[model samples]
Target chain A: MMTSTDAGLPALIARMTGDEKHAAASESTLDVLWVLYDRVLDVTPDTVHDPRRDRFLLSKGHGPMAYYAVLAAKGFIAPEELDDWASVRSRLGQHPDRNRVPGVEISSGSLGHGLPLAVGTVYGLRAQGIGSKVFVLVGDAELDEGSNHEAIVLAARESMGQLTAVVIDNRSATRGWPGGIAQRFAIEGWATATVDGRDHEALYEAFTTPHPRRPLCVVAVVEPKSGQR
Target chain B: MDMRTTFLSTMEEALAVDPRLVLVLADISAGTGPVLAAQRRHPDRVLNVGIREQALIGVTGGLALTGMRPVAHTFPPFLVERPYEQIKLDLCHQGVGAVLVSSGASYDMAAAGRTHHSAADVALLDTVPGWTVHVPGHPEEARRLLLESLPGDGRVYLRLSSQANARAHLGAGFLTLRQGTRGVVLAVGPMLDRVLAATEGLDVTVLYAATIRPFDAAGLRAALGEVADVMLVEPYQAGTSAHHVGEALADVPHRLRSLGTQRDVEVRQYGEVTDHDFVHGLDVAGITAAARAFFR
Candidate 1:
């Protein structure tokens, strides 16, 4: 039986079914991905390769059913493709490869690859006189990768105004950050927002609010991975 | 000019002409003032990302995504090995390429210990597909190749060596300095002069190559002729060219021997480059002895 939520996401997610599916993983990112694809990002199907178009990099690319659902719903990718999400002929793999998947910015599966890549993307965009905003979505546990620390500190140091890091806090790390995820970004000079992960209005406001001069971090606190809210 | 100086100056020149070229430094290389000067002149173009080699690669991959060609600079261990995942995922897997210019090739800083050495760096990169590796024999070759790597979206590893050939081989596709019917000997990068010295009295053809990637199969095929005995001498690890050579001469029956740094022995002691080179059988005498034994 298909379960429908207030946002009609459960129907979209029902398209992907398998034994190894990260159900909790996809559910955590669904709302944030919807909010960004629906209201925040200036990217569309046509503007993907446009120089000035906004870039939305999915740094936390693990069991990316929610990302696929969001991309398909927004018309960036076809909905039927989600049926064969992990099949041999499916362009949609468990982890997203940007070359094969439309609207996907970087090919990411490794934990720490995204934030640093986003930092570089923002730098490149700024270098070209293209002021398009670059957004990266990372998991709270993903910050455990030392490479993310390198990028987080560097991104804050560079004063990358157009870069935004939306860290989904699901209490996934084994040994969590000392002062929580938002504090890490705050210590590094980013304008931060800690919000309820499932709330649509709060996410939209946090993402759209002016951080001005410094990069912004919206820590979307979600349910723990232990099936507890 | 030395290869390292030319590396800095060529970057400065390229940055001046190409607006799309982004220079990222890891602060592990010998010189930074020239590059930092370029950063000062064009604050947007050059970035010194501190000693973060992993972040260096991450930044380079990011720049490549935005249609900007990045020349990510540092030593081999730091530039290639430390951030290898960054290179593999962010650059190659993402279908974006950057100019990875690495100094202190192999044992260039032999006295600086194994941490500073990168003989296996090219071998590591060869593990990944679609990378063009160039080990320049001279500063002129380094300058030319570095300039060539900037425009294309292809991934390049421009390895600079402290020990250089007294004269440059300007020709392409393996310059044949001496021709013979006994066998053919291919020397890569800074190993050319020593290779030439090693094969002085031997009845074998000598070929000097600065560019190692897309590995000159046609040149090897044409030069092999009837007698197919071949020796590949590289400045990095031994047998690094074995894969390409075997592929190039797959049909022909040939005797091949590769000589370079020894992989088995760690040589835990530190000394001058010559000391390390002697220990690794990289000196001219060692090359000659190995060449004599292989041909016989």
Candidate 2:
């Protein structure tokens, strides 16, 4: 099994073929996934359903190859399943299906949906008196959805310190829209931070030590290489 | 009593009974009627997420996740249409226990014009899985359904109106107003009062569905039983309830008659009218009259 210490996600992604590679190459989200699988998310193949396992929700789920690849590498699924990605019977598809995938907590693909569900999961855990942390990785473009802003404001008011919202910013907010989501989140009273998307250490730090009294909003600034796809 | 007053008093009673109950409001504060007063009485439990529909649903999902039962309120149109994805993915997909209290159905927002009127909420919500759609025709049913949703795990959409004084017969599943030898009339939400008034002294049974999603199939079959004709009355589109009943009772040799607004975008015009006028304009009266002709 490919372990977390494997060098560079790009090299690993290059080895993939068919829909899996195509999806991974299209977006720069793989770097964030690498950090999640390699060092941050505290889950093993055997302990995926452990009650105390940290939950990760892919809010920006359009290109799911990054998630599939990380899961496959982490031995969550066999590597051969990546070839059937987006097929009629494939568990790996354009969007994440929580029921089909063991590690997935909620099915997500539509923009502005993951944050609220993540919030709900956090709330559910708290209600059951479960102290497990929830990490939701959302695309910067998803902030254009008014619901994301609504969730941000509410999370702050509730002081949902256990929930960490990481905004993966490839700087792809549609033209003319205000792109300063980090600033917006900070203004709303969340404990905000930013990091270079490709840096594993920075991503690890952000996920490991979330703010104790407020939700943590991390904007991972990234830029994909040209002709990568 | 105004339906709003009853709805609020019932909700406050429920809240007093359960510490987990929470009410989240959109921009419209005073407009939600008595529910607003309950929120005011319990400020810590009420969350106003401005006018954002999507965010309102998401935040409510968050609250539900944390062990709090969140009842989110918003304009019917915004709640059903604008934040639809949030409702579907966050609440239904995640299996969160969040109640969506939406005002404005048919003529509920007549003065606010077409933009505010939510004509397709029932039809839209019916398409979503695991979400119970409760279109309470009067105050009492609204109270009961709201109370029932408090301890449940799934999602609920309470389509309400500003008309507070509407009367409702209290019971669970389908309420039979009259027992007829022929097929029964299945009425949804507040339309129960209308069908009952229309069929007074006649030997026709009116089955009022409090929960639209699970839709009491055995209860419906038991009530309608070998009656060869079934008529459905609703404030939503014709196919909404009729289609589901037909699918569920495919083996029963019954002629299904549906009464509601036709599907036509051009016919969209907003105006001030009581529930009676809106139902009558949608040909509910004509359809009932036609059902009588078929019986003869």
Candidate 3:
């Protein structure tokens, strides 16, 4: 089993290469995942069940090689498990399952489930008076689903200060949102920011910026899915 | 009070006592008496998340994931059908549990048209596993079932309706109300009183079921005497539990008859709840005619 003492993100992700259809999907989330797990999130393998720990929900769960790699790099899972990710005997599947994988907050492959769940998680923590922060990662295309809009409206309206939605925009959406994706969240009363997805410092600064009483939306703009950054 | 009212009032009580409980809504009954007061008192605990049903269920699952036992309320179509994928993946697949309390059994909002009606709720839920379904016939029964479901973290769907029996049967499995020698008639939830009234002079055993998901096959088998003729009177779509009946009586030689709302045809014309019931052959006269034809 590969541990924290071994290979880095690129090598870890490359180990689980065969049969992965959406390499772009996994690649687009690489820096954001590394930044969140490595720098931002307060969770570790031991605090998976801790009520007060920050939550990271991967709403864009398709082509999860990068996510698995980051989890392995952060010591949430055994690095060796990535060797047989999609195998019949492996706990890891194409999409992540929270039950099988430690530190996964919600099991998602469906397009629009993550943001709504994150909003709820924020609401739950606020209700219990716990100040745990929640971060959800969604693809720009996944926002087309009406369910995400419902959550977008709600999270801002409720002023869920503890929630952060990081939209990984690879410019892959079918009918792209006019005036960009950040406006969609900004108009709905969310605090919005757009940053270079691949630049680690930009991603980190955008993530930690404070927006009290308002849910924050950080759009990590990456190269289009057709090109490499 | 109605079943909806009973559910709200009971939830209000639960919120006051349990710190782990949360109430999520989709503006369905947010402005009403108990809900309004509960929301005022427990602002954090009671949430009214606009009219978004998909988000309503997704949010419910999220709360459950945090170890909070959430009870989400809305109409049947919105609660059970609209965001079924969320129910499948978020709650069931996540291995977390919440109490899904839905009003409007079948066509409770008769004039609201087909969009509001959801006879396929239980049938659609049947497609997924690990759900305990309760079709409560009266407000008191709805209260009792909600109380029973709240203490534990399990996936429980409590179907509350405006159409109700005069009294409540608070037991699980099939409860035998009347005995006979000819055949067995199972009345599910709100269909109990009508089934009893329809089969008054006939020689048949009538069974009542409020909890239908974990279909009590053992109870049904014990209720059956020498005669293996069985008839099911359900309040939802026809033959919803026919498979359960078939599986329950797999060894016995039996003839099964199912009577409920029509699945193939859409009755667009809406006037009254009773009118819809009659159109669906769930009224006393319709059930009587169908029961007599099968039993005799």
DockQ values of all predictions: 0.90, 0.48, 0.81
Instruction: Tell me which residue pairs clash in candidate 1.
Output: none
Per-residue CA lDDT of candidate 3, range B1-296, in tens? 99999898889888999988999999999988888888888898899999999999999988988889899999999999998999998889889899999999899999999999999999999998899999988899999999999988899999999989999888767899999888899999999999999999989999999999899999999988779999999999999999999999999999999998999997898799989988988888999899889988
Best by DockQ: 1
DockQ rank order: 1, 3, 2
Q: Summarize candidate 1's per-residue lDDT along A1-229 as a digit string, tens digits.
A: 1121544556667888644455788889988888888888999999888989899999999958888888888788888888877899999998999999878998888899899999999889888888898999999989889998889888889998899999999999888989888888899899999999888889989999988779999999999987543
TM-score of each prediction: 0.97, 0.82, 0.97
lDDT by residue (tens digit), candidate 2, A21-89: 454223577767777767777777887777678788888888776677777777887777776677888
Model 3 chain B: ten consecutive residues of lowest lDDT: B167-176
Top of the candidates by lDDT: 3
Residue-wise lDDT of candidate 1 within B1-296, one digit each (tens)? 88988999888888998999988887754246677678877788888788888899999999999999999988888988888878888889999899998889988887789888888988989888899999999999999889888898999999998889998778667888898878999999998999889889888899888899979999988787458999999888899999999999899999999998888878676889899778888899889999999987
Clashes of each: 0, 11, 1
lDDT of 3 at A68: 94
Q: Please list the C-alpha lDDT of all candidates, in the order they appear.
A: 0.87, 0.72, 0.91
- Summarize candidate 2's per-residue lDDT along B12-71 as a digit string, tens digits: 777666878877777765456555666667655655667777777887876765567888
